[model samples]
Target: MGMEYEKIHACSNDCLLYQNECEDLDECSVCHESWWKKVRLYGPMYLMWMYLFERYVKILKAYFKNRNRPEGCVMESYIAKEAVEFCSEYLSNAEAIGLQNKVDSDGATVIDFRKIGYKNDPFILATQVKQVFYTTDPNDLELSLVVLMKSRDIRDGEGDADDCNCIPSVSRGLTPVDEVDVFDDDDSNLVRLDVEWTYGTRSGGVNRDGIDYYNNLINELLSNGLEPFVTLFHWDLPQALQDTYGGFLSPKIVDDFKDYAELCYREFGDRVKHWIPINEPHIFTTRGYEYGSFAPGRCSPWLSPDCNGGDSATEPYLVGHNQLLVHAAAVQVYKTKYQNTQKGQIGIALNVPWVVPLSQSIADQEASNRALVFTYDWFMEPLKSGSYPAEMTTYVGERLPKFSEEQSSMLKGSFDFIGLNYYSASYAANGTCKRINPRASTDSCVVHLSERNGTTIGPKAASDWLYIYPKGIEDLLLYTRDKFNNPVVYITENGVDELNNGQLSLNDNIRVNYYADHLSFVQRAIRKGANVRGYFAWSLLDNFEWADGYTVRFGIVYVDYKDGLRRYLKDSAKWFKQFLL
Candidate 1:
């Protein structure tokens, strides 16, 4: 009963549903659902508070003086409507203007914004605790980004709480993997805040200036004894590039990417070991390029997959086919030219959400299998084994794209390593790819669906996408190792999000728990003989998330939007230093 009211008080979950359930004390409502999570980026509390404060005494006096007045008796409904209006405006303001801003003595300012109420708290910012990154700042340069947060992550004096978040039980030897350096479009060590091109006003980094900025940054990183794991693109495609050749689908991109890869390899190959030719190609292909989620935004569910954008109903796989070819050609060049001398290995990074079946029945299982094969296996087999999964052929048909014999040979079994990008988990039902909505559980995400008889459960945290089932990651590792013959695996991305009184909190106990469980999963996979070698947290700091903008934050070190006051260590981050290092 109390939990139900908590929803109303916070304007969380489904308030109407909660109220309906309350009205049916002994019975049930036609519309039955679950309780809500935190307020989305938009909620009604801001207005409610304003209305109550504006004229409480006046309302009381009016009620006594005008008890018989028709309009006086209708104050309650008017107040309710006003509150709703106010909340919409207030939330819109927060997302746009963001939380209060503060400037440090150094004069760097932090821009922080809260996403709407926490519907799927974890989903918007991902919940899988991969490598917990310790980041401070990044200049618009590649090399500087490599070392952006490293020096600052060090604790001062006995590791006592001196502005940095710390863990008493953590040990120096326990950090899972060595910290990574940062990179950017600037050649400097510190990121450019005032400039729109590199920071908030991110213009696609297309010009020679941006490339030089990256080259210099990478050079600095190598000088610092840091091996580079370069992500060629990080949602920073120069608007110029997009305009030049239809972007992703433009045939010209193949040659352009080839040139970029060659340049990256020639200058930094001697030191940089890992390379992700494209970062979350799916994201770039679909969300950023096709739909208007990131930049060059569009809203198509499908279409223009590779070079030309199109609708989701049409298999965007054809366009993706072209992208895969480019990836293969790049790998071939690395092998035939750079590998023997540079002695460096490379792999394409893939983002895969753990998809579970709603039930144990054949239909649900089939759906899960298809989702995996369609989404992940599509990328894996083509790169690792050098062939796309056969199942995809039937589903995608002609929309999938053509592969010549020579191209297949080059593309098939083409990887030196496999990078896994894990985040939230979703469950699918027994239906067609797009038709699984009714059975799929996006709202009741923490509650895994069931087909057999009993309840299907997962771990629950404050996040909506984070069901805290560390076991899922373990399962993911085992699946990857088994499917790919135990190729070297890297956990490339993961994190969580939470809020505090009127502001967000970085205490992040939920995050700590989230990490322990997932890393333990990684450890279990290692013990089980999975060749997992390294991990990198999703982010070093909370930057503007695409489409969603600055709402979702995944940084281990909180970037105080008020001022450029960067403090070190959240609870999970401190714990990670000891337990994982």
Candidate 2:
């Protein structure tokens, strides 16, 4: 009664266990026997399966209230007994049944339930009792954090109570003051703020009120001992620019973006030492232009009737090419006009999942390489070599834009650092070129998969695409070092998400372990001579996650969406605080 056990129905002939994928099966496949059989096929129940456990069988049979539905009655009674036992453990002040309580080293009560049965009872080993871990002290288990400084990014719309377009009457009325306190409490030294071009720029000129809002936010962060790592653009294109010239799809937006960067540099560059001109251009172009899943959604009508009319085969490449040019123009402006005077570093954040070959076949191995070229190297290669990757040029052909000699010269070696946002990995297999309805999404001729031969590459997180493979971080860093000639790297975004179950609990051990495991790999990469400078968790507070809305939470500090957006420090924050101390 003190231990827990599950009622797993089995085939009467012992042909199979009716569980997991077989839970719904009404018959056994091996012997073609009915699943509800009450007796063994070979012998009487007392003389066969229950010979030694005759007394236990009698106890189980006594739980049945209905002769016709014996199994269901016994199951219902057993579940009720288990529920009562579980409730009593938490509701009562007395020691849990069959659990021995002792004081741990921290003078906190610890419960040990491993000794539930008689010492010499062989049958006890067959019971389904699992070891229980109980501790009263919050600090009993300390999660180790990486030695690198912690940073977090704030998107334009996040943390602001007022309209993103309107300036708040008071500074305190806009930015969540308590959220900044959480950052301080967690010992985070850096904050990355995404500056929306639309928020600060209109057809007339720079919005003074918008600039003032950022000024107030920057001052608040500095006052709290947090350094600003400002991102000039996080896909928040000014609608005016988009409407006038189709945004990044046209080369005209390049100068406009550069002007926006210059404005940010003049206003916030002195205080915001770290600048990331763009974030995840590959994601933006593919999702926005090719798949039409993001803002300014545009794709071929054949791909999606909802698309706002775009050429999937060419628009993504055009947009991506223009984004590279835009990034280069901004970097060129910063390095020439603002960087020396402001003493700041500028870079771009690129998100890419580490790609592993699906098999040892040469074609698959080559596909993995091509996949990286198309994603990470889509921007990085041009920055490194002043040319698109050879694989891209070969596969995408004329659809992929070519940089002029002047533009290529400007793009080469444009950044002081590279901001990397890695969250997951995928298996790559070779695929034939799509002659019909070809798009940038499949231009690399590589099939990306999250699983390999029925088993996932790693344990999946709440996000369907996010598989937990900590080693991928190290692999990516080392790949960057060897492939891109070891440019200064900062992990701009890395964190796991969990479903918002509409409960208020600050215990997020999964996130704590995620950080610990990934940072350990980062440390390994650093030891192996990868030039990673810092690590920023994806977010500090739970906010509206784009298309996911408020369904998934990816923050160390929990935000109560229902109750005036109250902030609470999750366990991961405590771990970071302790480690930083």
Candidate 3:
């Protein structure tokens, strides 16, 4: 098709279609033949995939060379095994687990009768294989059968002399069994090839096993009657991307993030109905680029001496601009390509700390509104009306980047939903700073406080910045509903942390109370028609806390970091379990 071109010309008067028999006409031959034929290009039907295989090999080689062995072991032994087992168990319990009246290529009825179990203490899976008709929509039926039969034979030591060497040996190179001579009379020599029995076990090995882990998680959740709300990028930017182009600081990040988001939609969007493209852009831009407390730290020397070098006043705004652009790009891709087919809703998580007036004075009230404008409206205004907040333009002036008409048009209503991360609330008072330079923290002309005078708004959490204010969530929800025309919302992150004191008792009563109190407010907001849909506890387990360096625990399940990272369910976990029930 690339070699084919239509040497054709159309009449200037639009009298004829230049195609087929008219392709070779010299000029507008029908209309006095005044012009010569021009070339009409045709798109090639098939480009090529031969070159892609070589690049695919290179990708696999690089992936395995840098793969973490411990993580791989957990994935294969636990996550993958559990996924396969869940499918087997689910199908077994289903009323009808087949193609019903459909037949295989051989024109035969297919039936799934496979059983899977674990033999070893930690779980070495064994699957039972059975004969079945093949189908285009091959679920786990065939694979389970093969795995089960192979595992049974291996366990029973029933392989032929030469076939014994074909058994799978995980974590170790294949060791051939005793050699059998096949040169005897009426003997045929059979060569056994050792293989790894795992997902993506073929010639090109598994890269990005996290996909498998998440797939299993989604499958398990569905099997247990639950829906998954997946967040694609949660402030974990790749270090390599950061080194290559300073991560979110450059416009180049827009396409990269879009590609990543599209890949997530392609892979997991089938099961995940709610997609959050990026979580908490405000935190990522301010903390990582402005405060210089996070990875690839960059900030002005005046703000933090730990920073290598950066313009705090400029870089934060630049990063924030690029993040919004990237997010809008991802949302555009999802809406244009994936939303209809995948039937999924996409949104971005914005961490907004509800701002309250320090005093009943007009200045304090205005300051509180400015604080919200600088934080929430910084992103929401662009999303809602295709423009930045008027307050931001007036305060930041030239420090903030201006979006062109095209960019603003792309950003407007680029979400099917909105994810809000509300943890605590702060009182905002008119700023008194007369500093020469102002960054994001002070650009709003407001100061945030957890308390006024000697009285605090609410009890403080383990985190120094957090002060419990459950009513703030209800207020934020109601305000969002009214201001944003009642868009669907999810409380993506809302929880308190506790100190990890290395104690035997996992009695996190504070966390339990915190959840109960906050949930009561959420219920009130729901009653008032806030359009709130779902809520997520801040964390599932104790893990890294970025700059805090795991000094505090925010998980309902306690993790013993000193003891092989063992996990134990705290009282909060038990309480949460019952609450969910």
Candidate 4:
């Protein structure tokens, strides 16, 4: 169905519903629903896409020719048709009542939803992995090896291991490493450590002390057959670079990023097999530049008053262009300098929501395709075809940045694999583009909605923007396979969130269902021959969420903010343990 039919406004009490009638009402006529609820930012009209017709209703009460006989109006005809259809459906389903009566018994019947239910394991047996490494001595480049022993570690301090003892023996500061034999206990548990190279700590590039720290960390991880998937830059750019020339806005960032990547390759490439040069470039650029909700916040004055000064139309594309260039340069450095010698693979992580066409109409189908072009193909096209999508170039025109032949060549096949972060889906419809005001977000000329026909696309999450749609993961994977030549794809990030409610128990049943359903879709995609390799949940712990702060928790392991940051394995974590077994 077309998204036009989905434009519905209902009173808080569900007493009165409005469709094409009284769309501009400040309050519901019946219950007077809260104005804030009706004017929510996530409403269909204010979404990322541009639409020709506003989704809001334009009431023309004067058009009623027969005010007394309102049933004679054209709008009333559709309501009458719906009533007749409901009656017919009731009559047709009457035969099913016999089956229901037969199925219903006098004895109490148990409805077992345990397979999909969220129930924590009575015993907390799941392992929660944490990073631990030796302290770095600035003077000495060599790392002293040590192993800390902790059976059932429970602490927020320096040396805390999981269920098994694969802990780092050195203290936080410049404490000396206490050598402990860690090879004593080797069991069936798989051990792996995730290490991140320091991008820059507010100052310039990583100093000698930070370099030494990472060197020690990698050495420790490798010593115990624990391989590391090192992420070079996790949206943590040095403040110096940002201050120097607007960081990703200028072309100057490419070389500096290359230098950083080369340094990472030279230092830890031997142990770090998988290198993600940049994590979620789309989020970094769009959120940071266009929306100004993130660090280095910059956006048009109309978009946000908090922004210092930025053109939402131009800066986001510029930032994205620079990110691709920087990523290409980093990959080139790795390929030329370290790939053969270090035996490592490098890729960039990109986040794109699955876009579903709001209607079967050609306009909406085209709009859906354009939405993907602006989001997923915005990066993937450059990486694969050495150019941006034609749809983007056509719609955005000169506003969309371009890559030179050399830059395009470098970007093409720069990655060893594709890292995709999929979470939710939205309905895309043809949007009306206004020449007066254009933006990177609205450049695609499409409108997005999380619901259709007054029914949500999926259940809502704690995050207002996030709607749970597990089928989106499968559809996205298949789309990537068909469109992007079926490259090796790793689900780099996928998870849902919930509000941090202190009144509720630590057991997170919703998260368990989220994982179960999403994983099932991933499995289906794999069965359909999507070259999917790995899947990493968005987070292991409920750490800081970027724009939302600590308001929402996406962690499989819930972190108690009030309780000394103590971690409790949520139902999802226990479910994962049992699932993996």
Report the C-alpha lDDT of model 3 over 328-389, residue by residue, as the tens digit.
99899988998898888888889988988999999999999998988888988899998889
* Model 4: lDDT to the true structure: 0.59
Local distance difference test scores for all models: 0.46, 0.63, 0.57, 0.59
Residue 436 alpha-carbon offset, candidate 3, angstroms: 1.1
Model 1, TM vs. native: 0.59
Error of 1 at 320 (Å): 1.8
lDDT of 2: 0.63
10 residues in a row with least lDDT, candidate 2? 123-132
Best candidate per lDDT, number?
Answer: 2
> Across residues 133-172, which tens digit of lDDT does each residue of candidate 2 receive?
1111111111111001011111222434333111121121
lDDT tens digits, residue span 163-184, model 1: 2231111122111111232312
TM-score of 3: 0.66
lDDT of 4 by residue, 326-434 (tens): 8899999899888998887788788989988888999999999999988999989999999999998988898888889999899999899888888898999999986
> What's the best-to-worst order under TM-score?
2, 4, 3, 1
Better of 1 and 4 by lDDT: 4
